[model samples]
Target: MMVMVLMIASYSVGSIKVEAAEELDLQAESAIIVDAKTGKVLYEKQSDLKLPPASMTKMMTEYLVLEAISEGKIDWDTTTQVGDYAYGISADPVFSGIGLIQDKDYTVRELYEGMAIISDNATTITLAELVAGSESEFVKMMNDKAEEMGLPEYKFVNSTGLSNEDLGENYPEGTEPNADNLLSARSAALLAYHLINDYPEVLDYSSTMMSELDDQPLQNLNWMLPWEDNNFVPFHFEGVDGLKTGWTQEAGYCFTGTAKQGDRRLITVVMKTDSKEERFNQTKKLMEYGFSQFETTELFEAGYQIQDESTLSVEKGKEEQVELETSEAMEAMVKTGEEDLYELTYEINENNLNENGALTAPVEAGQVVGEAVLQYKGDNDYGYIGGIGTEQRVDLVTTTGVEKSNWFMLTMGAIGNFFSNIFTTVSDAVKGLFS
Candidate 1:
């Protein structure tokens, strides 16, 4: 949608090629890393391959629950009675679940903690049922929310992410009994991007390495977390924090991980790795590559005036032109030393201009005239998530107002223009006659 005009160099230099993350040899079937703040993609590998998300599908459930709570539709303290279906799943050891007693009321807070901490299937189903009255209805919400969030590839058949067949006779009504929730690595990463951004408190639950559910010890499945006493301390990475992990025969070992060091937070997704540890290992590689290779760099400061194109001609105004500037700073995740590869380009809002491409008189200061967009001149700019807002841009606004010329000044200008046109016509005739 950006109708770009001319580009201006943001930095004076660049030539040293920054290494791209494509060089990373991950063992996963699909993988991706993205900047949490901007949703900018740092790396991707077979990212569009649709694969089972397994318990990572619970992230959608987690998002909805938090969103519901935030909307006051449901409170954490609100209680929902566990039905026969959820209780049965809880008692089954084949699936990951903490036991739930049928017909017993459990607070949303308790069920959410159980689902998030341990990937409890029954708790997930219970929360789904609580939110939408049935797991089937919750699946509709899941698919609808996915579309709304702009996930490129995802399908939800049940709230728990278990193959509906795995749910046996209890599979939600009006769903394919054998269908399992599926998501591409890019979709998973984008979902996590929205999740942590929209509901940061999910981290409060995800970051807890250990908690108890009904006296039953619950352990976080994400081993890459920086818990000091972590049994998987060998996999721990500094700054690594809360995220979800998953595994099933179909999903293999999948993990959606996020970590923050300073103001930069990175989200990673690795799917269908050989082992539980391999998923974390692949994620660690992505984390290292992102942290080491990228930094949040300011490409252009707010109010940066583009040289040569900084002013707009104002027709019938006191001033011939009015100054323009960027309304906000343009910052993006750039390779540490590759800041110069980006240039600032601007697009004029033609609708705001006259046929002569000049602003009408009485232009207001700070009115949006166009957009200032960032253009990368380097290799492997993976772009942002969803591909909709790929262009990083800010509003191009007027730096100062331009008042309309007084009637006398306007009349004088018109008279001068009329004579100038006649003189030009006479001069052209004389030149032709001389020739």
Candidate 2:
């Protein structure tokens, strides 16, 4: 028999399967939380509202630079000379510079770390120029990449998410002037998904809390990394590691963050928050809510015995029945209180079997007589259901062969054995008589 388990996780607007304690009150102007593995939106509010991403836009810079290194277009050891524009602001504290020096070269690795760890605008712009010849051209690359990743709403006028106010909007005629990096919370989350999924090595830089460049302490503005008590962190939540943070007079405070607890990893975004503290506090709350309301569940496990209802009828086999069992574990993430594992709908695939009623007599143990589909109720996309949640594949394993049985079969079997058993006895008896 073949069984596919589709689990529709419990979470409802009216008595949702994974309902919040109450309507979660959030301070951010727009926010969203997603499962990194599945891309399921655990919670979202005004997710599609267009907003400035601020320094979080650097995720794209990080992505482009990393991809360039991966494709052999550049290497970590390759050095780039800081442009005059980057050098001028490299030490501008207001713009978050890493003190890049003009005419001086820094390797791709060093620039990447400076940008990702300290949110340094100068290093990021320098790397962008290295990859695309200029920051404006790099902005085009960022937009092009976003489009390929299916993020239509992501528009990058510059490498940094800084608003137009931060950098004067007017530019010399014919020059591509800077604009705010506008992306919806949803779009930001999707960008994060692509960045992490495509270039996981990005976490190495984004996860750092404190580091230095030539002994100058480069402190991370993101405070939720370790979730421990310290003066550096105003709010603490366990399992958060990476992404980026952003702020501007027009953009306010924003964060694209990731956290992992056990097997569950989440990506969350908050936009246009009132203050630095509110963003962290809200992010912590969002992570806490996710961990509290949902759970990762094993829909089916290896060696799991099929219930009586899951068994199937066999045909033309010695065995009257066969059982559908899982040879490997199948798991999913569901709401906290959700009890139903998954919906297992099964039918014996008849393409291979010559006859239907019971499995054909030649059936062998471990043979795939059927397949198992995984799904759930109410949600066709929950967990392994809609490609929106955790994944679990069912490896079907059949029991030992029940060798064919029939009157004609028995006669044929006996006749085939006559030469070895009956014929030998008859020959021995004749020899004895002749002697």
Candidate 3:
């Protein structure tokens, strides 16, 4: 698995990660600590191994539901009848899980809290069915979204993190709990990355230690919250906030947790620990180590002049050469104790240039002429493989004889522009089909 530092102007996904530094041992079978602002992995222990994520799988479910609401496909007041499958799981009353009544309808808002806070299996299935019409179909959507998010390793057999038992008689006879909700610690962190960053409001639900369902108390499963009693949890972290926790006889104790210390937010995923407190303890250790041990370093200044000799050769313009410079700065987060810093190198992408490999004479100021790609190598100089390195247009200009192209060349340029626009439109429409 790879981790990388990203410059945050805002949050978005769809990029690959590269490996960075290594850290101390963790008790969990698979664990990862990620810098939320930059998606940098501060620590890891078998993070790429596939393991049963249990209820932590619900993170993806929560994200999808929230995203649907954000996109206006669903509303807070939208309601769905509690079906047989959802009602059966709710009625089980095992592990203090919420019981939903058949022949009754529940709003999306209610189910969101139920699934997020208490990790209610029935409410999870309820929202799943409401979103996709059936559990099987909902599971498909989960996998699809996983692939879309670059986590092809995740496979969802059910919405809730049920394992170590049959899904009961409510569904088909062959359904078993925790069938294939396998995920890597890295994948889980990515899910949390999108969860907290894309839907910052989710913390509102996950951070709650308790809530009410039909006037009955609903307890949050996360043991790390800074709340009274902590249900006898060994420690109470000051900034620890919202996230999901899961466990089963087969999956053991697992938690996908997050916390904010100062301006930095960190995400930790610990899977298959010996007990609940252990998972929380290890996660706490990871976060504490991250905040105490690392700090951000500016690798490059924004709009830094990488090249200003004004010697870039022009192929067909009136001018013989044009000036070039970088358009954006790059930042990197590194360990605090370390003295050496990440190295930055710049290069121009040939493919980013226009026809004739020259500035169309009289180019406007600030016009993009080529691509400037920046790369990084850590203090060890081993290279940051998945570093989310920076890329920007190399803006440049020319002042005279801009309209030098003959009628034939100009006609072809116009025709090429027309075809490019058509292709882009078609591509965007196709992408919208899946979104």
- The local distance difference test score of each candidate is 0.88, 0.73, 0.70
Tens-digit lDDT track of model 2 for 1-435 = 332332222223233455553477999999988888766666788877998888888988888988998999999999988877777667667875767667777888888888988888878878988998887788778888988777746678878766644556322122345556789888888889988888988887788777777567877778887735576456767787798999988789999989889999888899999998888988888888888887776655565654554455665556766666666765555665443635543445565455544465656777665555555554423222122323334656675556667878667766877767977898999999989
In model 1, pairs of residues that clash are none
- Model 3 agreement with the true structure over 1-435: per-residue lDDT tens digits: 111212212212233343334545678898887878767776777777899898998998898899889999898899888887677677765745676777777899888888888888888888988887887777778888887777635767777767525475444223454264788888898889888989999999998778887676778877778657846456567688869898877789999889887788888899999998898888888877777776665555555544333335553444556555445655555565342333333344455445654444544545554444334333343222123341322333222223355667668878998999999999999999999
Which ten contiguous residues of candidate 3 have the minimum total lDDT? 1-10
Output the lDDT of residue 343, model 3: 39
Question: For model 1, how does the per-residue alpha-carbon lDDT over 381-413 read when each residue is reduced to its tens digit?
Answer: 788887766678889999999899999999999
Which stretches of candidate 3 lie above 4 Å from their native place?
A: 1-23, 169-178, 230-234, 307-311, 315-319, 337-339, 354-357, 369-374, 379-435
Ranking by TM-score: 1, 3, 2
The better-scoring model by TM-score among 1 and 2 is: 1
